[model samples]
Target: MASSSGLLPSEPRTLPSTGFQVVDASETIEEETLPGYHLGKYYPVRLGEIFDKRYRVVGKLGYGTTSTVWLAHDSVESRYVALKLYVANLNNTRELKAYECLDEADEKDHPGKTLIRKLLGSFQVDSHSSNGSSSHLCLVHEPLGPSLKEILDLMPPYSFHLGFLRPVLRNILIAVDFLHARAGIIHSDLQIANFICDVRSSDKAMFAKFENAEFTQPTPRKIISEEHIIYTSRRMSLSKALPLLCDFGETRLFSEAGTPGEDIMPNVYKAPEVIMHMEWDYKVDVWNVAMVVWHSLTGRPLFNGRSADGKIQDDRIHMAEMVALMGPPPLRFLERSTRMTRALWNEDGNWKNVAPIPDITLEKLGADINGYDKEGFFLFFRRMLRWLPEDRPTCEELVYDPWLMRELGLGLGR
Candidate 1:
């Protein structure tokens, strides 16, 4: 399939119809590890490429900030899988180790694989057209559907009901709990994009149909951007499907109570402690899951830092928004925090930069969880959205929440 220049083949190459524009797979593309790689750029993978002589890339699935996921046919398992190829020296060793911890836990009592995406295997692949270039770290995972935000995009304005919202959101919290308690890892980047629709097929023909399913391919959907994408529609019952929590590049050990993380999470979903540089632990995950729940209910971001002019604002704006929705940080919280104190308050406990956060009650959040599901939703919501991390309910406690049980009717914790 060589073209006249002998680089790209003249034969037409198939591209994903996922809507995001991509370079022709046949174009002369440089690997990210190449000498002249640019920011916000990655090597465009071509179809029919083989990884470690086992998985052959056939279609494009999606793209993340640091990697690109391809639909590959697994010769070993005789099934379709996803190959997440990362940039060279991307510091993914820690993430792999975290997965190992999860695997070890799964081998014992907890079934972490059922909650998060299954890590099939990992291997390395040589770069394209780079003479003697280093191999890229490729993570092999089970195939999953579009992300939660993607499904939300497909819904009409506020079309998602509490019935769908409850189950899906609870499942995400369950996955987060797995990472925090069993795995002992902090999913520093917990957001809607990191959650994918959980679905799989074993039938060869059926799997093939799934491999070629027409859906919006996610590109340009930057993980940390202020905007949310609209998916328009989905081919399956997204609510009935589970959510697979993926991406662990920012993961870390769930430190002891007083130990702090240097940096973690995107600005919008970031916890006050994390943003303010205070001691944080698994509670950051708790804060993020609350934001995820709100987004699920409203199909709008719970907090955004961008200005009305579409310009990205500073982190102070995010803090302002949190204060607006959740009310001000507790005085004890203010006392313990240095960065936030200097940013928002003076020594006399007087407000400086922060505005008085107005009232945005739970009932106004959506349809109010409705007649049968109000208690469960509100109780869980109140417990999880606390200003103090210590005040927030642990994942274990949230599991038995009346709201999740009664509202979701999930029989999750019985």
Candidate 2:
């Protein structure tokens, strides 16, 4: 949230992406401080540190491979904000551009569309630490609550009302549409963790509904870890519980001529195009979001690709599962995946390198998909889980699909 106090708003905020932060070739590390935080070179920012000359860090929100987010008070604007600081080496100018495009848009610009988190501002700061002189890019954003993954962890593994999922799915679809069609960006990473609950939703009943809910706490890492604080929907209520898309580091603007790296999305939510190393577009986001909706509704993954031994099956296994459940991959896609020809398939378009994994069919995954319009639910799935990316519906189409419509009480399709 941009502060109304006018500190940053008072200044000329636009700046170029270059300058500062030299890397020494001889530098090496023997030990690291923060675990689960190995994505980039971390800056040793102590608590209560003033950032970008204005915002004061209050608490750490969360940390990821590339950056660490904090709950900050923008003293200049006199408003709370989400402050994301990225390590110097990551160089996330692409993500910065994505937010710049979104900054020009608002919910009012698109009538009846769902809301997405807004980026307030961004600036770079140079810090000299024991690790060396590093330049960090700090982005200011509207504050959001815990993630869907955190929310789910707060509940019993299977405890959630099916009806509670409709708004979330709708909201996510709206954000995806905004990213794909409006912003010309693809959310290369789409997972439960990337969806933050709107902490300031005005819906009282929505917040009240989860008052009695339990939030799972993280295990002991450092004694000062945020895990020590138990967060219920009520206690950590930054505002409301409306779900919104967050995290743009992994996002990329899609184009026909440009071919992004094949390994773009998370393993669990990867699209078939990504699996087969095809030049993909917005369709990958559709595949990812379908799985997200499924998990949100059922509290179980659409594809539980890992076994009891914690061995997540390889891509060949994943491809076999997808093929068994959704039928064969498109012939062109199979032919294009020649890199894995010996390990995944044969000349006959049949599985050769992988054995069939049991209980992976759509019927099997949807067995517990009751207490709602089951047929309509599968209809949405079929439209989304297509073998060919070109054949899948766009975000605009899926948002109005009969299944979403039924859940939204807008009537069913044939």
Candidate 3:
């Protein structure tokens, strides 16, 4: 029984009590007064409001610097969907174009397709307030559960067991492979936050329960003024635990190879080629996968890229760490970036003492792994962590690596 204006049935003439708690204006709520936050920039979304004449807002999911995400019920499809509303006047053409590329790709039969989050639809909404009118871009997507980072936070050890980590890694590699080989897209930003868990079964029931709770026990909020209200975000329960690669805002379309000198990726996960300002390609993503594996298994970052005080990131320190762990860059490799080579190394290709290289090795860092599988694990890392991008294995090759598939009973007798 969908209403003409929305999916849910019409509300009663006399609305029921919301039972919402109001907070003082001075109290901080979700995304209130954060950097870049301004009135008329973000669309003032109200609970129970229907957008695009169909999807009804259930509750706030979360907010980022550029956008706010909400859980909504799609009346036409009779299912729950997530709505990402970008700040007014923000340029989101890159992300939209990436989705368009994915939609046009002829890889429907690819197994990795299911591991990537699907974009449902998109539209523009005009907001009118006392200040002015602004148009916001809204993207509709399939609802998902918590991110891998959030899940890790709940774990006491903040790390995943090998059994749990294996499948997640395999699925991520498959998804990356699909993006590279089929879509010709490179997801430049790959991190724990972008790896979200999928909500597969019992989705309807779960969303319905969430909507009902919003009606009976509304989320607390702080009303700043007549036009601004900050509501606390509601967290969804864990789902089937399948990892989906998300966030295409930084994705680049590659026809043959990547464009050099383009700054991408978080500082900590940056590849050597990226650090040296040299040509990079899909292998940069291979380097990212290695860092992710190290973080997930060790519960700590392998590279912090920090200065002496650790208050800011310094490339010299970061490069020095790589030297300590992987040894000096080959002269052939140094020739790729003459400027960086001159700054960090002597003419004879020896360390110029720009920064003190730490005394460390991969074996010492990963010594905590059990004796039986330690060798295999480091071997897998060596295949991807090479200073030369060409030396690193591709996502497809790493998917079949002996270490990742050893306990899963895959890649046997190879």
Candidate 4:
């Protein structure tokens, strides 16, 4: 069951084949369509070859930076499953080390590895490149919904229902807590864009009811379509209680040893301590959770900057915007910043590492200003976006927040 936020059905967009594609043009097209230039129309391994020949690849479901997901049917199990194949580039020592570490930890610490993307199974498959020296390795998982970012983009003035919001936030928080508090990992890339709705059988029932609205008894075809739609809409609710902290491509193990710096993450959700290269920890994940919750409540990202180029200037622009909304970093915090930020501090006591917030102001333009009705949503935003990392709430505090408690109806954990 695949749960999607905002997908409108349309004819698949076809690309014109160029005899010799230029690097620049190919780069642009690849970025917009596929993450890489190699989008195989048909690959070497289909459903029949893997999982002891029980699964059959039906069609492509989704794509990502390092993998392509295909919807598959398990013949023996009589069910649909998702097959995620890792890109060949990830077969190197760096990624291999991380994968080995995660696999070992999952068996020992997590056992089921329930919160993050479950590694259904992994196997090596033959490659079909011009130079087929190496084979591809793929992992299997249940299908997930369109990312929160994609969902928001498709919706008009993007918004999530309270029914959806409360549970989703709960799930995200718990997942983060597990990653930081339990697994000793930090999901460096924590954002609405990374959250996927995990839909399953219950959606079929909801769709049945919805389809039956038009007729005393709806046709099988109509019911099936409705079921698919409902499945897409509500698969991975926070109520499901699944740990779905995904995009571990940026994840890092932060023991007493130390943590990686801002260089590892996208500029938007990065913590100030990371920007300043200070001793950071789980609180950074908390900051990211706050940003995700804010996006969930309001359909807009709290710290979106104009620098899509992912440059240091863009980071600066993002930081300045954050400072404007949340206030300047504390003097003590600033005193500890690296020379980069020290040289960047502005007259307003805000770090000059960032420029003035761009003309694209969320409040002034009402771009990211929706869904403010829930109590303390703004307060949550204010707290999370504190210029000083120490000023931010811990994951434990956020889990027990009044706003979260009231909205989630977890007064006594009944």
Best by lDDT: 3
Compared with the true structure, what per-residue lDDT tens digits does model 4 show for residues 312-385? 34556766776666566677776665565666685456654446655443345334444434335555556666
Please provide, for model 1 over 7-110, each residue's C-alpha lDDT reduced to its tens digit, 9 standing for 90 to 100: 22222236454565444434333233245454324543555566788676656666555777777776655666778988655757877987888877643554
Task: Score every model by TM-score.
Answer: 0.78, 0.79, 0.90, 0.69
Candidate 4 to truth, TM: 0.69
RMSD of 4: 9.6
Q: Per-residue CA lDDT of candidate 2, range 1-414, in tens?
A: 233422222322322222312223243221133444432265555445678787865455666667767665676677667778887666888778777767655546663224667788998877664446778888898776678887777776552455567667778888888887677788878888888877543432222222112112221122223222211112344335677788887777766322734678777788877766667787888899887877765677776555446676567667767777887666677766577655677788777746565556677766765456666667777888888888888888888877677765686532
lDDT rank, highest first? 3, 1, 2, 4
For residues 140-171, could you state the per-residue lDDT of candidate 3 as single tens digits? 99888888887888776787776677789999
Q: What is the lDDT of every predicted structure here?
A: 0.65, 0.65, 0.80, 0.54
Model 2 TM-score on a 0 to 1 scale:
0.79
In the order shown, what is each candidate's alpha-carbon RMSD?
8.4, 8.9, 3.4, 9.6
The most accurate candidate by TM-score is: 3
Looking at model 3, residue 3 earns an lDDT score of 27
**Which residue runs of candidate 2 sit more than 4 Å off their true CA positions?**
1-40, 104-114, 158-160, 201-235, 256-261, 306-309
> In terms of TM-score, how similar is model 1 to the real structure?
0.78
Clashes of each: 6, 10, 0, 12
